[model samples]
Target: DAGITQSPRHKVTETGTPVTLRCHQTENHRYMYWYRQDPGHGLRLIHYSYGVKDTDKGEVSDGYSVSRSKTEDFLLTLESATSSQTSVYFCAITWDRGTGELFFGEGSRLTVL
Candidate 1:
């Protein structure tokens, strides 16, 4: 099984504050992604990295940024948190893009007051 971990599984912050969530993986997978789940909007991709120092923005990438300094770790940061950004974030990994299977971390819940 793929080994995935996320830091600060639960977080609460005031509006306009900055927040960062970290995701670490031991699987050495080539592709890692960050997503947020919410009602009605479903799951939306925030960012993803294909290799070390290689990253790309996704659909809802406006307030989110990602960094992949190494193959085993990916970080997602919210430059300035907002109420609308409150949601459960997830980290996922996949070795084969065509496989349609992704290994996901437990989740990180963020609340902006």
Candidate 2:
């Protein structure tokens, strides 16, 4: 990964609150994704963007949304944070879809009470 960063590496919020996590990349990768990691769930995709303003829902898209208006940044937002959504969220980037190679940012840990 040439450059990838996740903001607010850690956060704590009350239930029903709104939260947004940011993932930014410097290499202008064409594919970016948001995934949540939890016990026994491994990594479940929440959303992905193929290019600027082009996004699609993923396996676990409920209560989550994503946007990528610029090639360098991807945003993952929870309309209303809930206890069930508490998990470590990760941002990943890939050069292309066929290569199956993905580079991930450090991660963002969210705690919902």
Candidate 3:
């Protein structure tokens, strides 16, 4: 079975509205990350947390934020939605500091109009 799951699975929102997406993990891992996958660009990290309340921005951090108040839950927020944010968002977890491979969730598809 997979280790991660993302909520909403799909969503549609108008421009300038705030949105939040949730990610849950049962793998008991130490690292959780939020990323967006777009055509041609592959996967780009939005944010990541190594421990509760310990988070950091990623490559595409603008207009996005994240929180991890517990071991199994991580949340991503979009301050104000825009058409550029319309993409498939994925949550990933890594087992340990050794192997770098990531286990991904089903994904949340958000469309901003």
> Residues 37-76, candidate 3, lDDT per residue (tens digit)?
9999999999999988999999999999998988899999
The residue-by-residue lDDT of candidate 1 on 1-113, one tens digit each, is: 57999999999999999999999998678899999999998889999888999999999999898889899999999999999999999999987555857788999999999
Ranked by TM-score, the better of candidates 1 and 2 is 2
**Model 3 — which ten-residue stretch has the worst lDDT?**
94-103
Q: What lDDT does candidate 2 reach at residue 90?
A: 93
Model 1, C-alpha of 19: deviation from truth (Å): 0.6
By TM-score, the better pick of 2 and 3 is: 2
For model 1, which pairs clash? none
Q: Which candidate order results from sorting by TM-score in descending order?
A: 2, 3, 1
* Cα-based lDDT for every prediction: 0.92, 0.92, 0.92
Cα displacement (Å) at residue 18, model 2: 0.5
RMSD of each: 1.3, 1.2, 1.0
As a whole number from 0 to 100, the lDDT of residue 103 in candidate 2 is 81
The whole-model C-alpha lDDT of candidate 2 against the native structure comes to 0.92
> Per-residue alpha-carbon lDDT of model 2 for 1-113, expressed as tens digits?
54889998999999999999999998878899999999998999999999999999999999998888899999999999999999999999887645867788999999999
The TM-score that candidate 2 achieves is 0.96
**TM-score of each prediction:** 0.94, 0.96, 0.95
Off by over 4 Å in 3: none
